[model samples]
Target: METNEILRNQIFEIIKNQLKHNNPPETKITLDRLRAQGFNDSQARQMIGQCISVEIYQIMKTNEPYNNARYIENLQKLPKEPFE
Candidate 1:
């Protein structure tokens, strides 16, 4: 697979795992909230993936550990887009 496709698949797998395990629980909740607000499963998941990307970027750029709080905050702001 191409590099971008590989990364997207990796992110997709992370999302599937998050939903499967409900590690943060917020992930599933965010999925439901987005659905209720009229986003389809794919759209909602893509939005969630964007949040994950932001978290990943922060981790790589700052060399800090994952921040669940920031991730959750980004999720709560859905469709508005995640900047952090």
Candidate 2:
């Protein structure tokens, strides 16, 4: 797979593993954790930002009740240009 695709998959796996442990859906992963798992600083940051984006999307597209705090926090953490 391409490098970007591989990175995306790794981020997804990290998010899945975090969720699998029964962490609240709004729990945010820390950059240190991702870095300890072998991701470089930039990659770790990107992954965490992506995770926040996904969580926000899920809350919006589903019947789940909106969490004002989590929504605001995730939005604040989101990269300025998420699609870049």
Candidate 3:
């Protein structure tokens, strides 16, 4: 498989985990909010996945621990395109 597709699957897996466990709660909230705004399930998860990607990028770039605040903030700003 192509690398981009592989990465997307991995990111989606993380999103799936978040949604499954409801840890932090915001993940599902964001998903539901996006769905309410007319986004389909896959589309909403992809949008949430973008937030995950941004956080992953920052963590790798800065060697910082995961930033829950930024994650949640990005989630709340859904369909807005994360990371400014």
Candidate 4:
């Protein structure tokens, strides 16, 4: 994969790991957190998508039901991938 894809995937994994054994948060809440941490809107969106990927992986790995609202919200923020 390309560097961008790698970065996106890496970010996704981080989110997945971070959310492991936890409840999904609101999309706006996640975005707000990212922005508070100094990420721009674009970056915030990317991070959200990463979080969604993480959530999905977590659900599959643990066979537990994940939050659908947050996942949908994050999915809305995801770009086409292969960031520029």
The C-alpha TM-scores of every prediction are 0.96, 0.38, 0.95, 0.41
Is 1 or 4 the stronger prediction by lDDT?
1
Clashing pairs in 1: none
Better of 3 and 4 by lDDT: 3
lDDT of 3 at 3: 100
lDDT of each: 0.94, 0.56, 0.92, 0.62
Residue 1's lDDT within candidate 3 is 100
TM-score for model 4? 0.41
Clashes of each: 0, 0, 0, 0
Specify the highest-lDDT model's number.
1
Q: Please give the ranking of all candidate structures by lDDT, highest first, separated by commas.
A: 1, 3, 4, 2
List the candidates ranked by TM-score, beginning with the highest.
1, 3, 4, 2
Candidate 2 regions exceeding 4 Å error are: 1-29, 66-84
Cα deviation of 23, candidate 1, in Å:
1.1
- Residue-level lDDT of model 1, residues 1-84, one tens digit each, is 899999888898999999999988999999999999999999999999999999999999999999999999998999889998
Expressed as tens digits, the lDDT of each residue in 1-84 for candidate 3 is: 999999999999998899889987999999989999999999999899999999999999999999999999999998999983
Best by TM-score: 1
Q: Clashing residue pairs, candidate 2? A: none
